[model samples]
Target chain A: MAKRSTVIAITVAAAVVIVGAVGAGVAVLGSRDTGGAAGAKGDTTVTVRVWDEQVASAYEQSFQAFEDKNPDIDVKLTVVPWADYWTKLRTDVAGKSAADIFWVNNSYFADYADNGDLLDIDKTLGSDAKSAWAPSVVKQFTRNGSLWGVPQLSDAGIAVYYNKALLKDAGIDPASLENLTWSPDASADTFVPVLQKLTKDAAGHTADDADFDPASVTQYGYNAGNDLQAIYINYIGSNGGTYQDGDRFTFANPKTVEAFQYLVDLMNTYHVAPSAADTNQNGDFSRDQFIQGKMALFQSGLYNLKNVADGADFDWGVASIPAGPEGRVSVTNGIVAAGNAATEHPEATKKVLEWMGSAEGNEFVGASGAAVPAVTDAQPVYRSYWENQGVDTSKFFDVLKNGTIPAPQGANFGAAFGAYGPILEDVFAGRVPVAEGLQKAQDAANAALDG
Target chain B: MKWTRTLLVYLVLLTGAALTLAPFVLSVMTAFKTPEQFARRSSLSWPDPVTLENFGVLLTGRTEFGRAIVITVLAALLLVAGQLLFSIMAAYAFARMRFPGRDALFWVYLSTLMIPAIVLVIPLYLMMAQLGLRNTFWGLVLPFAFASPYATFLLREYFRGIPQDLVDAARLDGANALDVLVEVVVPLSRPIIATVTLITVVSQWNSFLWPRVITTGNDWRPITVATASLQSQYNGNWTLVMAATTLAVVPLLALFLVFQKQIVRSIAITGFK
Candidate 1:
């Protein structure tokens, strides 16, 4: 009898304590919010967001210069790692709480601009301001007759990185690698023979030897896999096949089929490249293998220049990407700094954006050797920085003279990749025939984009 | 036959233990290697000349991982204290009292566990932004300081299984409700309480998504977010990342060491083992 009353009393007291603590927590949180806003009282604070920590550090020095000239405005940089950058940006923009300026890639620009989330660059910075940046990035960002972002950085072009000692051991001259060209016709091909000479079996036999055992391969000659940017897309373009045409997949073209067949045969037939079973799941497998001195040739871009320079303990040199039947055509991708359309501090934000696009401001990125600036005039600093390290930067830049294809540019490109990624993985692993796989992948990619 | 069966069981258990411990062993091994050594050698290989450089870079360099550890500790401590206190009181009420709509209210609160956390991210982010709490310590910890549905449910079920005679005897011995709770209920519920505390601390420590969305700068960022920043877009720096990971995991491991006995007893009593 006494227990029931005791239980009631305890329940009442507990309820009061629970409610009181929650109320206090909310009160403290609310008060702190007010304090934070009030603390930024003197100068209008404009925030900038980026994904790369290296670029963020470089921009810290650049923005310090910006803040020195404009004493009344303060700039703060926020870095989100690449894994969460898109997710957080989408949520923040939808909530109307994104930074005044944030970096956007080509694949995501169309979505943000279509949703009216980005400030129209042509309208904000005038159409004449486009001349200050690289024409390729400007063209990539321009849609429906208005520019969407200020160009921040560009991937110059793809190039070949060779392990000099490995090439020498294989009796292959590094200089010959520059002029190596491939063709679908085996009689006309000069590239595979070079790779075959570099590859070896466990019994110290090169792949070209009659006694060479494919199962016991100890060294690979090249990195050929399902890598879209580094391996297959460049091959597709160089072979006169198209991967995309006006926001749709065109990978089922006959030339694209021939290119895939050549790549698959390099892995499954000739065994000059690592098996696709290894490289399909791990995108960094080829780069790591090259750095480990197990592979002779690695085709990648400026993104990997510092990776190889810092990671490799052996001597290495950069050379032009092997040309195909048509020519050496590489994919050129770039990143842009887009402004918030509804930013509260429009004047301050525009000032920050304008400074980011200028040659003096962009030079900080190039001078640090973190990336090549999109501003053409600032590119010399990047070249000179690499030259000081004894690396020839022209290998990356020289390919730009022949021709280039833009990186995937539709808003649905990510969705399209998701739909076709597994099929491509199967195709690369040689479980699916090349022609049939490309057709299935093309249909799936187009369905995803058109849906 | 008995000896052979026991030997077989021991072999299986040893194999399982090795498989479980392999990745953690590799992470620690990798953390002690230089970047070049990490890329050159097999992942399972031991560091030849073990270096402190990765730790030095993580703790003293621009990553400022030491500061992140301090912030994570403070947030986890606050969250554990608040969550345990409120959850205990709430669970006790739901178990003992026969109030109006008590079961209905309890059921309604527990139903929230069915809703996914991803659905709440946008709304919660908007609320915090409107309050000007973005990038602030309060923004990172405040939303999670209250009683969670899962914790409350676990505690309530355990409280219900406690003998009612214990409470009645305390009442007859001239003890008030508060005395009965502090001296009787809590003293006997040590194992479950320890379990709750450990669970709260570990979840709050390893929390990534909410903290990633809430804080932006290093000033208020926690260890999980800072550890993620060790890898840039282009560079993996696996050795450096593994170092940061090893540092972030030490406190949780220490906590487990301290409370292993009570946690095991809780698992046994709850029939979860």
Candidate 2:
């Protein structure tokens, strides 16, 4: 009787296993058939891969406009989102099954272009297309004297975005912010006093007051700690320091040391900026405090102007970066649109690039107020758009014209960027001194470049 | 003294539970928020408007959240079935059936577990490509289906624990080896089978790198791949990301809830008490 009962139980378990197996098989078959039917008609479809979904719908609308002009080409815009973009793109490229055209960034462009993963656009581009965009945009994408991508949007380095209300309360004239300058030797003499004058405690005592407590200050004078790439590169350029001297890392030089000292003074000696601990706790968006009516000035990209305009209720204005000993300088960063070498429809891909690089298309993207147009001629459209939106974008163009310096270009730009970022964070935290941090970063960057 | 011990146990359990669930709870709260809210506040708070806009947006695409759920369910079912069937059969052969060098073969199978998954990825990928299975559902499913040496070894031990008298009785009644397996060994191996099923389903469902590498389109991608892709798309907006994450976790959570009885029983049977 017990044996019979055991046999029955075994039969039931077997039946369950069989049923589950059949169900799984059917499900797999059903899904594949559905996918096949959906993807069957491949003739009329042209997929454009992008990295941001918030921007994907916007691109869809833009592509609809493109389709209206060129009715023959049916476009399908796919958003891969930024986080998965590189991983997905690399896999697709390796499999020879990538999208026809997709967005590219400066950091990853060299690797893709060198590996023949990006389609060379030099032969296809017209003279007007070649000359319309910024020279730096063209230079960055150009590999072995052949351009692999068309410039879509350009971003310049850190600009001092200050709260006008905070400046007013501190008795500092917003009009007096022009032609701002700072050198390592001269910064404490000029900027520190300005910082001290601006910083105020909750009890309303200025940092200059004898009874002032640095730890208890409610409002800071300057905002500096965030991404070291943005802050350090700006410092290095302003002090006439170069990251590399023809493939050799040169950040251990005196000019770079001067840049490092200036940053250290802002946090430790001056007591006008947020402490290293506070910045460590807060991370990159430490600038948000400035927009929220806490700090006086925040240094970040002009691209953040839109975010501030949308999020902040307070009045804010832009100013040039404080000049170092050599001269005033800003870092250049931008997005590029490139055709996948694995694309079946290279002709259609070229057409998309041509249209995107055109004056009308660049102006359309610029007018959206999401990013600055890479085209020099179309920048006025962005400036006016922002001006109408109640922020002066004149300085955005002025920085591009006078102060824009391209970010350090190297073979392993991505690897170097990743490795040195955390070390710089440690430096900013005062756990590691600036000299040691920079030396460690230089060593890492060199190793990455060698790879 | 009793109250103190109870309190200590409760505290330990609650802390463990909180550590596990906090990220998930935060993800759920963030999913309903707008991009602006997500960016400005990285805390676990409910969105002001409590919008279903991200879900609405996710639903419109070809590889929507709903589709990803279906794919993941299908993959999990396949993985569980394949693991159970193969592991039990192999375990039965090693545990009861008299064959030459059976012990040596079982040891060889167990040894393969030491070979890391990373070492096989390239060769497996190449094999799949050659087999014309790349980017297909079979491409993602087949390589992982019947390939768990640990699961087989686990079941072998459990099958070995079953009394030999029942197997001999079934064989004495003119039952074949297959019939003996079906009639005697399987019924007693329920606890281990349940444990293996749970482990197989969870691992396959949460797999990221393999599925991401094998599956080209959203059509073949499982929940983990889809969730990862969604997270990347809304990287700046933690709210929408958290929502997608919440959606991805629901099925696994539901499975755990449904199988909780069997799971607990199985764990207890495995001497984990």
Give the number of the best model, judged by TM-score.
1
Clash pairs, model 2 backbone: A81-B233, B30-B239, B31-B239, B31-B243
Ten consecutive residues with minimal summed lDDT in candidate 2 chain A? A34-43
What TM-score fits each model?
Answer: 0.90, 0.85
> lDDT per residue, candidate 2, A1-451, as tens digits?
4676576677568768765775675565555434233344443456677775544655666677777777656676666657667777776777776778888887777778889888788776754466888787888777788887888878755678888888888788876766567777773335667778888888888888988887788888887663544577778888887766744577688888778778877777667778877775454445566655778877778656766776666778888777676666778877788888877777777777787787776676677677777877877887788778877766655665556555666456777777776777777777787888889978887887777
Model 1 over residues B11-121: C-alpha lDDT tens digits? Answer: 999999999998899899999999888888788788978999999988887777877886787687678777887898898888887799999999999999999998998
CA lDDT, candidate 2, residue A324: 71
Q: Quote the B-chain TM-score, candidate 1.
A: 0.94
Model 2, B141-232: lDDT tens per residue? 89877848988888889888888888888778888787777667877777788888888887887888888777754657777777667654
Fnat: each model in turn: 0.41, 0.23
What digit string (tens of lDDT, one per residue) describes model 1 on residues A19-91? 5664564454445333254235577778898988788889989998998898777787878888778877887
